[model samples]
Target: MTLSKKIEHLEQVLNQPAENFANSFKSDIILFFDDNFSENNTQLFFLNDLNSKEEIQSWVEILTSRFVMKFEAEFEAENDFINDYLENG
Candidate 1:
């Protein structure tokens, strides 16, 4: 898939509700990089193509930050629910 398509796929996955969010994210990211490596002929391209490597690195950083924010928000919401239940019960 093209870079845009891959990004779109990631966005889609990010929006979906997953029973296991971390595992889902890991599996999707692994598949995304695997496809990228195949498209570039191999992972060695990362070593030779500075621009491509930088672009991918940027994306990884952005994605990781987003994932962390999302996970934290979810965790806080769940924690709040548990606290409310305990207080009310």
Candidate 2:
């Protein structure tokens, strides 16, 4: 079916509630809404927020550092220590 027809069908089936649906996508978060339609539009809003980035960076730094220390202790630099440690674990 055509897109418009499908949307219309959804409206009928759902009884058309005036609300927004929002969610996150890994690095991006979005909210679906329509202001111009003043009716209903399935729109996407990407959120560029610092909190998520900070948290992710913090996790990576924490995990990588923890792994690196164990790696260095177990294998010397002459070996492919870093790569091998990660791959083996």
Best-matching candidate per lDDT: 1
Model 2 residue 66 distance off true place after TM-score fit, in angstroms: 1.0
lDDT of 1: 0.43
lDDT tens digits by residue: candidate 2, 1-20: 43444444322323333243
Worst 10 residues of 2 by lDDT: 22-31
Which residue runs does candidate 1 get wrong by more than 4 Å?
A: 1-28, 32-36, 40-50, 71-89
Per TM-score, the best of the predicted structures is: 1
lDDT string, candidate 1, 62-82, tens digits: 554445555455345533432
Candidate 1 backbone clash number: 0
Provide the TM-score for each candidate, comma-separated: 0.31, 0.23
Q: What TM-score does candidate 1 reach?
A: 0.31
List the lowest-lDDT window of 10 residues for candidate 1: 41-50
For each candidate in the order shown, give its overall lDDT on alpha carbons: 0.43, 0.30
